[model samples]
Target: MAPVSAPDAALRFVHPDLDRGPEAGLVVAGDGRLALATGMLAIRQSILMLLSTTPGERVRRPDYGCDLHRLVFAPNDETTHGLAMHYVEQAVATWEPRVQVIHIDAHRDPHAEHVMQTELHYRVRRTGIEDSASFGFDLSGGGG
Candidate 1:
């Protein structure tokens, strides 16, 4: 009998619940087939979608997203970044029950006058694995 490789061994022990199934919604694949995000990728994409959506944008779910858009025209300062961080933290915690937020950091982009960078650090609640996501909030009339 052939021995199992290390990678295969690791796959054998993957917790089933860590990747239960595809998340909500569907996307068109490269070949036009419907696809869905799964596991951590799904979580990350959901985070981005939640951040991009503004409060009251969704007709049925009025409170589905972060309030990042409200600061689009605000001054690019610590206060703005602070509010952004707060909004992100609140949204992820409230909407995404799969992960526990570790930290949220926001700051003005050093080279871009109208862009602020926000990074979210979180640990998957079920797996305890940590990951981070970064987003550029574009101001100056450009969408985030």
Candidate 2:
């Protein structure tokens, strides 16, 4: 039998959903399914970071609560998007005054989740806040 030719290095791994590997430098359009999962993960991480920074005195407030800030991954679908937006708007109106919001992600999410967060903190200034402020220690690769 002839020796087997090695599979194309680039095509060796195929995503079950994608028949062709993405072309070089081409970006995949964001998928609603992936966005929903990623957004949830990012929101969860943000909340955890917020809680970790809370001073011991502030943890017991009865009025304070956390919820998934709802959002629609589909922009043109009004019935669904409107419902999602309405839910988030109501939650924001109810919760903004009681709790602080945090965003933790490598790349900013531009969907409904991030939009609500942006509006929530629009007035707050991040002037002196370093990227490492929330992380407790600066991991910037620079000498002292």
TM-scores of all predicted structures? 0.77, 0.23
What is candidate 1's lDDT per residue for 1-144, written digit by digit as tens?
365443222211112212234543444567675544466766676777778888899899999999988888888899999999999999998988888999999998998899988899999888899998887887665663
Give the TM-score (vs. native) of candidate 1. Answer: 0.77
Q: Which residue segments of model 2 deviate by more than 4 Å?
A: 1-76, 98-121, 125-144
**Residue 90 local lDDT, model 1:** 93
lDDT of 2 by residue, 1-144 (tens): 243322211112222212234543223435522112122222333333332232242457543332222222333233433443343334434543323333332222244222212112211122322121111111121110
Error (Å) of candidate 2 at residue 57 is 23
Q: How does each model score on lDDT?
A: 0.77, 0.28
Q: Which window of ten consecutive residues has the lowest lDDT sum in model 2?
A: 135-144
